[model samples]
Target: MSEGLSAARQRDLLIATTASAVITDATLLPFFPKLFATAFGVEDPRHVGLYLAATCLTVMLALPVWARLERRWSTLQLLVVGQLGAGGLAIASHLTTELWSFWACTLTMIVFKASYLLVYPYVMRLVPKASHAGVIGLLTVIVHLGGILGATLGGWVLEHHDPRAAYLVMAAGDFLQMGVSVYLLRRGARAPSPEPAHEGVPEVVEASADDPAPALPPIPQRLSPLVRLGLLMAVVYFSAFITRPFFVEYWGTRSSLDGELVSGWVFAIPALASLVALGVQHMGWSRPGSLYKWLALIALGVAIQATPLPAAIVVGRFIYGWAAFRGLVDLDLALFEISPPERYAEDYSHMNLCQQGGVLIAFWIAGLAVNAGGLVQPLWIALGGFVVGAGVFAAYGSRFVAAAPSEGKAPEEVAPC
Candidate 1:
């Protein structure tokens, strides 16, 4: 077997992954509403909400299919094709003279976005098992860094230039990511072999001929622990996003703050929270049972967000963002611990689908709540969901916490890479 990845190769992989992630996040969040508004002649937040629902549906549907395809093709191959498809579709949206074309482009983006899902499993395979949590945490931080940069850069570009220009810049980043992925694959293929495998033996041979070959486990069955962790993560993601649709609606009815300033605060809060997530990574409070601690912090952040003053809301939003990021990091590490190598993509896909499914439900509920009641009502609902999710974890999550391998117990032998 090859000894291990060199530091340079690891760095290159991280850079490439970061570039791809940033571009994907940039395209979706800050720029998408603007793009849809311009291209479709629609400005209602409800329309944007519908588009998000469609995108989420597409991603959820495509993931299982993508996971199956990943079993047949290499990660590098899938990633390159995905990048090119996404970039091309994004550029094509700008060429659309009709609203239908924009819809078509969005649909195509769902297919392209499947590529972004593969990166997590690939990174997990590359890192040492002992360092799984730290590496996963680092990767999550990189992803947030991309999100932070993409949001800031997209905002700046949109202000200084046209919406189409933003897509073009994003497309350029996608193409660059494709190039780096190709290089990585080529370099990997060309590297000299260290040794030869035994002629018939699998890397992780089964113990008995009478034993049936282990079936490729279904996503739900293979990842029960991760599913538990995902339940908690879903709540966090849902809480953060449920109130999003009503931000503009809420501000529109208010008289105290300038409309633009209020909008800025809404966006700025998450961005500030992202920065806090980065800072918290170094603090060493990320072990098991950390979810409950972060949940308490998130509740405090929500309480602060409920305050009447704008300054308190801004600070609270930052805290929410911080807690959200920490929750994600811990949950991701937990997932890595529970997932088996053979089912990595399938397991990760399921976890993501679970999170997105919760997001879809929250968005739909929030939309209805906004139409029925008001903005503040949805925030209160999210707070309740967070509390309930934390309670569930506190009650049932202790069984899965990472622990030292016991005396006289052999380490679980993973299947061959």
Candidate 2:
């Protein structure tokens, strides 16, 4: 897959992907509710939740369409278009006074921003299978770091300057991403196509033929490997993200922390922990043999944070951050390793659609739970979701384990998971 690509181009593609990720993370992650509140004068928790859920829902709607577009366009071509659309929408949103218009522009922008979703599988296809874990780990680091930077930047703007200024910043990011994608697309045109294209979606079955399938639930066997993986991704994303929308609010109740900047840092504890994980994560002794341990630690972290103690909450974030990095890396590695190069974009889109579904539900539930009960309520729900997510992984994990890197054969030799 790496045959026609130069090393420099690979690095450039990664940089573009990282830029798109940081831009999206800066403007649209869970912390956006606070931004939305300040921007639109929205005070109700339900409104915040609904709007955030709407944002996520747009991504769900956009991914399948973008996935289908992959056949007609390169990922970079789509990114150029998406960034331009999103950037224009951001500016339009900034100009709007009415809440519904502002929301309409913002949500529409997300449908365009969703094109960045293609960056992951697009980059993965240019690299070798043996490098999957390392590539995924590094990308994971970029994502967490981007979250930390976004929170800090967004929080600072909210504290000292007009919160609406963040919209312009988002616009700047979208334009910058557009520029990078344009450069990459033009450069690639002068070079060979990254990989020989597949005619259509390849027929790759996930389960083994010789090994009898395990006693799984009533999920249809006809479901593609990517679709099955998507289901598992949905579960994990739901469990993990259930805590995100309400974290800043929850911190206010638990601690006297007054500044959005301070709260933002606290919100980014998991991202901070990602840096710590980077040091030891690549070490053989530190790596887990399976997904269960990481899943268990994530649950424990959520459980700890559910307590009212501020100190415990901080501690739990560290635990959750560390375990989440490992767990997500393994899960993503499983995803790309099994996916055929021909279907990288489409397969990842299917999986991410489910992942976004989980996040969308979590946003709604977290917001309403806080409105109905208290901030701590979402933590308990997240904890339960984590348990369910772990069970989902357990049932689906054998495919991942079978595809795991071994002494002689490449992980991709196993059927698509």
Candidate 3:
């Protein structure tokens, strides 16, 4: 291993890993649900719901395992293994004839997916503490841009070729990502580990040799006003996706336009919103006091989404996407400001669990709302959640400001829990 590689090399590796994950996600997302529905010969979208739910469930289940493995293996090793595993699974998913086999392959991919999800924390550890906002902003830009490209390419591939072909393309992307990871690892380019602030604190402590283990962080006990606020943010974060399953269902039942085309537009709304968010970050909206401004914008976005027109729906989605990005960035900054640095990884993992759990809950609630009311019910529910999320931040935003970083240190930064 080279003793002296530039910081740039390490960041480049992180970006490559991040970009690969985004590409892989984008490649699969557009058509996987439809593929499963077709393969199972199920007409109702809810059957496809199980496929999506399975991925999340598997990721949640594997969180502890990912954490444990990270202690034993390098981050690069984990990234390489995950990419190859997920890629191979993507290819295998195309070959499966039985629904059970499909489900099993999907679960296998989920194990890799969970590790891929850890890229954020892994990358955070690589960058200098003072550059947190900039590095995070750049990382978000790469992921979103990759998302845009992947979704666009995946949609195009699906339009011109078979769904299986689309999966093949995704598999190829995963392989390419794996190659990149292997190259970085072989070249001895790795992310910088977070340095300990005090002499007694070891930056990279191993699990105890004598003791067996302790219990996972209890979800209820981990819930604080801030964590609760994070849950609300999760609601808003996922509300954007709540209407996704129902897009085809609602369009087919109600609208005159082509269901597939409209669904594409619906997906594009978030992508467009992400672009606007990138712009906001460029405008320095990431700083303190900007949270309220973004929340107000989110409220406006919700109101726009509630309008009846299809164009309004698309516009509303774009606004919400932008708002969602800002909301998440601000909330993350707030969380870091208040959290102790050493406990950052645990806190972040807890918040991630909450966010994913919230998504699962939102999906269920949205389904019920649609069953009871109609297509528009989920929108209203999401709008309410965003309102509450914004309100919580506004109410307690002062607590965060009071805890801002001193002049010598970086802006109140929280380690990723």
lDDT scores for all predictions? 0.64, 0.75, 0.64
The parts of candidate 2 lying over 4 Å away from their true place are 1-7, 27-30, 189-224, 283-285, 399-417
- Residue lDDT tens for model 3, 1-417: 457666667677668767866765776464555665555665444555545655666776676577667777876798788888888998897788887887888789778867776666666666555667776667666766776677666666666665556657767777887887787777887556556455543332345889874443323433344455455556655665566556544544444664444455566566667777787767877554467667667767767766777677667767767766766666666555544544345556666666776666666666567767876776777667667766655665544233433222332322222
Which residue runs does candidate 3 get wrong by more than 4 Å? 1-4, 28-33, 196-229, 248-262, 280-293, 338-344, 399-417
Ranking by lDDT: 2, 1, 3
Which candidate number maximizes lDDT? Answer: 2
TM-score of each candidate structure, all chains considered together: 0.79, 0.86, 0.81
The model with the greatest TM-score is 2
Model 1 quality (TM-score): 0.79
Report the alpha-carbon TM-score of model 3 versus the true structure.
0.81
Score candidate 2 by lDDT.
0.75
Please report the TM-score between candidate 2 and the true structure.
0.86
Model 2 RMSD, rounded to 1 decimal? 4.9
Q: Give the lDDT of residue 12 in candidate 2.
A: 60
Clash pairs for candidate 1: none
Over the full model, what C-alpha lDDT does candidate 3 score relative to the true structure?
Answer: 0.64
As for lDDT, the candidate ahead, 2 or 3, is 2
Clashes of each: 0, 0, 6
